[model samples]
Target: MRPDPHVDTVDHPHADDLHGDDPHGDDPRTGSAGHVRVDTAALGRVAAAVTAAAVQAGDAASAVPGLIPPPRWASAYSAERAAEAAGHRMRELSADLSGTSASISTTVLEYEDADARTSTRFRAAR
Candidate 1:
């Protein structure tokens, strides 16, 4: 029989493994239902895009200010410097967020790949 694409083919929990709290105990792979749900691979792709945009925006924010015409007043220049400092801080924050999102995306994709491989092996064994 051809495998159903919607079904998660991981090893199902045996009757002995079922507990009162675990209602979908028959399918351990799904942890809820027999179906494969929650597309984390798509989420990872979105996260990657967000990370890239954030980093790019941060870089632009850091660089674009230098091109701004300086204020004629000395006091205004100090304010501009302060604003520039804030921009630097924002760049750092964006970089951190990018790193975190990239890490999350990588982890999610890796998990999905591993889960698919394990499920495939389990089905083959059965």
Candidate 2:
């Protein structure tokens, strides 16, 4: 019956600190002097690596059924089918991860390009 940790509760202790306030000084929402830093190149590289690892893990999982022979006992008869299903699901998950990684990479590139353009425009104005 406990509240979900991910959902923000209305009665949170720091909820009042997010907006305009002079009680404790600075606003919690805005960064120092309205500046933020992002490193898209590093993010893209890490995502790419995660994609590769997912694919590799899927490939290894798919090969597991072939590596381990099923037992002759009656209890193990259902286990073979379960193993096959797991391998198939792993491959599907791997493909999904790869697509997500590609999407993130594209987003990172676009974000970096936009940042560069913005910086260039500001420099030109000066």
Candidate 3:
């Protein structure tokens, strides 16, 4: 049978690319990297929402231009920069969704699901 495309049957995507201690996923190397990447998709939606509210609240939409998708990077940059102060914020959104690996793992039903361990206290009471 043909294998699933999303399966971890092939080379890891971000293994070589990711550095030490990545909190979002397992660290390929020995050391742990605490660099947890926030869900950009979530961030984008929230940012767009707040921007929309600003436009509705007496803020000129034309003066701001696009609402849902700001056609330009500069406009989004200023807001993103403000949101993520001190850190270098990139305007481009990450396509990788959260819990993808977990989803893939769960889909593989071949995993053992024998049964939960019987509590000794309950067994003794019987």
Please list the C-alpha lDDT of all candidates, in the order they appear.
0.66, 0.64, 0.37
What tens-digit string does per-residue lDDT give for candidate 2 at 57-99? 6787767746366568776778777877888888888888888
TM-score of each: 0.56, 0.61, 0.22
TM-score ranking, best first: 2, 1, 3
lDDT of 2: 0.64
The prediction achieving the highest lDDT against the true structure is 1
Q: What value does the lDDT take at residue 5 in candidate 2?
A: 61
lDDT for model 3 comes to 0.37
Q: Tell me the spans in candidate 1 whose CA falls farther than 4 Å from its real position.
A: 1-20, 23-31, 34-36, 67-78
On a 0 to 1 TM-score scale, where does candidate 3 land against the true structure? 0.22
| True-vs-predicted CA distance for residue 78, candidate 1, Å | 4.6
Question: Which ranges in model 3 have alpha carbons more than 4 Å from their true place?
Answer: 1-33, 59-126
